[model samples]
Target: MSFRWVAGRIALAMLLAAGAQSTQAADFVDSAQRRVMLPERIGRVMPAGPTAEVLVFALAPDKLIGWTRPLSAAQQRFLPAKAAHLPVIGRLSGPYPTAGLDALRRLRPDVIVDAGPISAERSGFADAIQRQSGIPYIFVDDSIERMPLILRSLGTVLGVGDRAEDLAIYAEHAIDALRGRLLIRPPNERPKVYYGRRPDGLETALPGSPANEEIDEGGVINVAAGLGRDGRIAITPAQLRAWDPNIIIAEDRPFYDSLLHDPIWRTLDAVRYKRVYLAPSLPFGWIDDPPGVNRLIGLYWLSTVFYPDMTQEDLRTQVKEFYDKFYGDKLTDAQVESLMRYAEAKAGETRRVGGEPLVGIGAALPTPVPGPGGVGTGPAPNTGLGGLGLGPPGRRVPTGGMVPLAPPTPLH
Candidate 1:
């Protein structure tokens, strides 16, 4: 054959090969019920939001291209060493800044997964990203009630079904146990809870907010229920006093400390009774912040605090196991203790009451001694109430309350 004819044949052969490779891709149905075509073998993946980042990390750490946000010094401690150095790729949801298309294109992720609420806007955004980058983007449902299924689905997509099943089973078991214990309790028996979202104790998550899902699942009556709102809302002291929650769960030390000392907060029943407790937040918040897989531990923690009698398992042991399995960190005794320091003392444990200190449940004190910031400096009065885990000392409070109402500026 002539040289030109031979070159023409080679070009046609290359085109056919390319078509075959394209046809080898697999198809996936995302949470949005949208079809996404992906390479049969996905190696590098990117999370489109904070929740996706945590979920993907637990199931396929090796597949993760980078984090949605930069890890802080404290957050790095809980994550694997390699994760500490991952690039900040930004996120696509919850008011967080979206990563630049150019930046994401350079990373060359095999696919992008946005795991959380499935809304039309989000679905459209994912489609737009895919069209712009020529990459597949999938949205995975991440409601608290659907955690196990989400895990299983992710496992299937990531080609890590065994690991995914393990995590999913754990999630299902925890949810079942929590439901069994909680559903049996009478409404009156369930403690009324208020989730303090910010340091001032003025901002809080209303009912239906994903951030408070664990608390709701734990069977505690969120005082903010029926508030006709979602996410963080500012409440006046009068509103808090009117609610008179039986327990107060705060996100950080400052908020907990404020409840102990803030003059207006002190008037509330939770403060007066020393029922305020801190929620653990290090690598991620156990209770809600980002409403991710990290909250799996929150289910156990809330169950223990709300119904110590019903929780047959030891809190410390369970926490250690969770950290090891999900976070890839095995916490030491000290670490565990620090995590639970603010948790309610077990039933019958001695607590300070009336500045005299009481061994068990006792009468309410007249007023706690005011500390700096109006927090009482003395040991909090023990009212025989239980609390969730305490956060580490000096944990920096992120801007935006437990849930940021607006997307934060992109770091990249």
Candidate 2:
């Protein structure tokens, strides 16, 4: 065949293939309000970032093509063997993308799922990727309150509606119950919380940022809200002192450790009053590193930390139940305890001021006392200890075995 003839034939074949794909695709509206032509039968899903990866894994582990990053030994212990061993494919969308166009072409995923805040920029990025790779891309809103809707919608698209509904209901109950408890105290009554990041504890998440979502929903005011919206920024010691928040939630273990002995930090009321708490990041960050569905558990944890008195359930049970349902791992009592050991309590210190016991310090107190914010009494009898338990038990997973990786087959 002539060179020109061969080139024409190749182009023709590509056109025909594109036409066939278009015919089989259906119009779907994503959370970004963009209309995307999604493949009718989506099998392999490419998660565009860490948030997308976690959301996809929670909804349909089998459909997920790969993880955005390799699972750590600690994370692998909490996940299913199949998921834990999945190859690490660099992310495609985010501040720093690692996945290249060649990688997407090789994977040839049925669809790309990007879960996070829906915005014009994200929609444009999805469009660009779709055009570049000739693959459909869908953005799902990962906002904490909108998670139920997102789960139900994405589940149906993935042919996992029943499972999605189960998770959605769980989320609904968790949110609703927590909201009811929050109604007990007005915004002023709630604590002023400062969420610190990094070893220096000077980096902080502002309002509308994913990192502070748990704190926003945790029935308290983010002291850093006045700084700005939607980004992590560094603050000076003067600014932190000016805010003088009643409670401090730190992301880095080293930062949390320093709060105990650092003189500069000791000047803050949160440190002096013993209201500083460390956020757990084992299998995943409890508050937000990826800002995914893992934060459903964070809502409960933060509530206990913010308002221990309003907590209604046991923290340890909640942790086990959340892990089994979302992570597919039935944690041993020891493992669960390890995750929560440093959350609310210190090893040797039961925080007290002048021989008077304070609330949510370390050990539980027989009588209710004023909490750090001076808003309410201590945690209810047997309620949250170390920010583990809060709110009512919605659903319980059967113990003594691994949680089923996939949802049960629905009855016709």
Give the number of the best model, judged by lDDT: 2
Give the TM-score (vs. native) of candidate 2: 0.77
Cα lDDT tens digits, model 1, 65-138, are 88888788978877779877888887755575667687777888888888765567888988988988888887
Scored by Cα lDDT, where does model 2 land?
Answer: 0.68
Candidate 1 stretches greater than 4 Å from native = 1-24, 348-412
After superposition, which runs of candidate 2 have C-alpha atoms over 4 Å from their true positions? 1-25, 186-188, 345-412
How do the residues 1-412 of candidate 2 rate in per-residue lDDT, one tens digit apiece? Answer: 4443343334334323433232246666666666777786888999999998988888888999998888899888888889889999898999888897999988989989998766678789999999888898888777776677667667767877678777877787677656667666443345666788888888887545677666656545556544445667777777777767777888888888888887878888788878888888878998997788998887777767776766778877888888888778888988987888778643322222222221211222323323346543323332211100112211111101011122222211
Which pairs of residues clash in candidate 1, taking residues 3 or more apart in a chain or in different chains?
A: 95-407, 96-407, 261-374, 261-375, 344-387
Instruction: Note the Cα lDDT for every prediction shown.
Output: 0.66, 0.68
